[model samples]
Target: MTLPAPARFGIMTAPSQVDYADLLRVWREADTVPGIEHAWLFDHLLPIYGDPRGVTYEGWTLLAALAAHTRRLRLGVMVTSNRFRPPAVLAKIAATVDVVSGGRLDFGIGAGSRPDVPMARREYEAHGLPYHDGAHAVSALAEACAVIRRLWTEPEPFDFTGEHIRLAGAFGNPKPVQRPHPPVLVGGRASATLRVAAEHADVWNYPGDDVADAVRRGALLDRHCADLGRDPASITRSLVLPVSYDDPAPVRETIRRATAAGFRHLVLMLPAPYPEGVARWLADEIIGERPV
Candidate 1:
């Protein structure tokens, strides 16, 4: 199996407190960075930290808008929750965005994990979305992935019966601009999640700042791929590291360690209240120095 090219960099920004105009400005500026390959938004109904009641923009809606506004940078959520939308509907949304962006969409998804805050839980309950945990959640995520792939690739209407999702006469129209659909990036390190990534993902993304943890998860993913008779190299290895604009040294070191750990794609999560010119500075100082 041939490994694809390496050293692609992305920035994952949370849509917290930023208005439409400001968000568009950030995206436009990030797009000008020479080595920045993609820009992503976090998928969260509420802020991950601080005041949970703070304003947070919807990821898919922002992505569609970004697709129209930017030309160079690939766009997607860092990982969208499977519970937020039906699998078929998610597929259609992704396909439409791919078309709008001229085939520049990376469909990142993950099993819905329970948030630590009560407000978040209330938000889920308010929307009547079940927030399952353990094996049930993993199975749902895996089934969602299967359903999405079928919707993108299968032409004839077909019934999909899975442990969690059941679809009748499902047909996805206006197939994605990207052949076989845009890259399905599965995020998580759980055994079941890795198994699903091995079977369905074009990319496997692990979060956190620890390089050792990333290495361990990558090895586990490789084992799962091997067990399933899949080429480990076929799935792009990616890591998402939260960055401190004030301290660039550690971020640089994290990039070095992630590269050594065999991650070809590195996504930096810029902290809230993103400083002016920081994205460009990182692109020029860190990502641009690496070979693509």
Candidate 2:
């Protein structure tokens, strides 16, 4: 059976404040927007790449709250770091979130970077101390995926015996509404990251300053999928494009270029204190056509 193109279009909710009610309102509005297939938020404790003082919210708690407020709109973290949470716990949490959202949850995982260093360095620091070895991150990620899968599909309690996480008779119930599992989306530019996605992800999210880079990275993902004997068609490609909107011409050009580059789902990352004005602008000018 031919799969329809993955749901296209989303909005990223990354704010400088930790207000659940305010964010929920924005997500509700987004759910009604025509052509928008999903909504996403970032996962981080402190600002990973910006001023340390920037306001950051807990990704899972906020997502759980979002699930309660919106009836539609697929929701998930843009990409969560592997080192932040333990694998077994993350698995159960994701399953619970999926259940809460009535199966609208998608999981995006990655090896994230710190403010001052490239993530490839593998030395992730928080509060001024080293946290994990670089090479070990991938192992943790794989183990996490394994535990989540077992939690969702395996009958009765199951055990996840891995180097980083160990589970004995862990039980998870009320399986996600999505059969088997919710879509797992992975983000990164590394070959190993791409390989991991090829093996496990239901969607591949590409981030870039421009559409061209996103397409380039997307093509790389396709190649990786081909190598792994997975159908490229099975993996949905999404892109996040930053917009300033000061110049209509440049922004339009960027959108045109991005669509041409095969970004089926494109989300714009807006700044904090997200108001109706930005949503209106994106709906009227960018998303095009009125909301549902």
Candidate 3:
């Protein structure tokens, strides 16, 4: 198969209550970055990194604001966990963001696991929501994907019956500008996750540092696609890389290795204190060169 060039590159901003200006600045700089195609933010009510009390911005609101300010880069949440919101509501939000961005939206979803992030347990009890273990969360994610897709495509007031979600005559209005719907990016390394990606998602983003591992995962996704009687080429495989470097060499090497390993997209995770540095690093490297 001929490998296509990456269509999106991004970093997730850990959500907080007060980082809107900084997040906007990051989006502006990334929009101008040479090789970057998108800017992503994490959807959470609290910080996933740094001090638990540090400033953070809401993800969807930040994406909406970034859409208005930056004319170029695509925008999305890294992966909206299935536990946090109802599938119908999530679908509507994704459509809204896509409209706001004029169709530059990538919907990345997954069974989110942030055990050390403090906010998980808090919300579980406070809201009396079901606490999902990894397996259960993955199940919920699969069901949610079907629900969201149905809500996007099925004509006016469709009914959905699923393991986790059941609905009758739910609204899926305005329809996403991206044909069919906005691209869905699913993240996980497990078999179930790959199954979900093969069956539903447009992209598969895996978070890891191993190139061979990414290749192996990509192959697994391909095999899963074959089993499902779907074309493996239809799903894009990508990586979420950490950019903790002041020097550009490491980041460049990382993207190069990942691309060579068959990852079409590199989701670069920008450093928190200086997010614009991510744009500068991308400009200095990896822009016009074809992968070797």
Candidate 4:
């Protein structure tokens, strides 16, 4: 395949690791770039890699602030943990933020997963949240998606009953500006996750460092869509990967291979303490070359 035209690019940053001042500066600078379509924040209570107790701003709080600060760029958490809040609450927050941003929100969510670290487990226990794993976690996430969709589209209050969530006469007011709801980007590569994506997501995102993985996952998603009697073309494919600014060759190659693999949306995960002018340079080099 020759890949689709006009690939969309986005930036993902860790708000907890980056200073608020620098985060604001980067958002402002990125807004001026023409080809950057969305700005994403990771959903983590603490740093995932190093210094587990590091300072980190809440994802929703930062998103709300960013909504007020930027005018053109769309904003969202790369993938909010489903366990962080109740589905109804998450729906309301997303609705309000979409309104605040004048309809620029892409709601990405996933089954919460934890790294093999003691602190990661402790954080979950400290917050009084169950840390589900394997199929159970994915099933819970599916139920969450169902609740969120109902809250977004259902006009009359109705009871929602699920294995993991239950609501009676629930209603979500001031629905998001986007019809039906904001674009839901489901993230994960597991079979259950792909099945959920096929059934519910407008976009499916996978995190990996290789294009081959994207290609394999894309095929798997197609199979899932087929099983559900859904059109595979209805779902947009997206890839999330880390890119270094010092080496433009590798970044370019990744983009090229990803495009070939049918990924139209490429979210570049920028390292903490982002290098100055790197975002602008990327916009100029990659996005500027693509036809509008």
- Best of the candidates, lDDT: 4
Ranking by lDDT: 4, 1, 3, 2
| Candidate whose TM-score is highest | 4
Candidate 3 or 1, higher lDDT: 1
In model 1, the worst 10-residue window by lDDT is 112-121
What CA root-mean-square deviation does each model show from the true structure?
Answer: 2.0, 3.6, 2.5, 1.9
Decide which is better by TM-score, 2 or 3. Answer: 3
lDDT of 4 by residue, 209-276 (tens): 57887788889999999999999989989888687776767777888778777788888888878778
Global lDDT of each candidate: 0.84, 0.72, 0.76, 0.85
Order of quality (TM-score): 4, 1, 3, 2
Candidate 3 lDDT over 109-151, as tens digits, reads 9887645546556656555667767777888898899888878
Weakest ten-residue segment in model 2 by summed lDDT: 119-128
Tens-digit lDDT track of model 2 for 193-290: 77777888887787554666676777778898888888887877777767666644555566666666555666777666665656667777776742
Residue clash pairs of candidate 1: none
Model 4: ten consecutive residues of lowest lDDT = 113-122
Candidate 1 lDDT over residue span 38-155, tens digit each: 9899787777676767788989988999989999998898899887898889989988999899999999998865565565566677667777766787788888888888889998
Model 3 clashes, total count: 3
TM per prediction: 0.94, 0.86, 0.89, 0.95
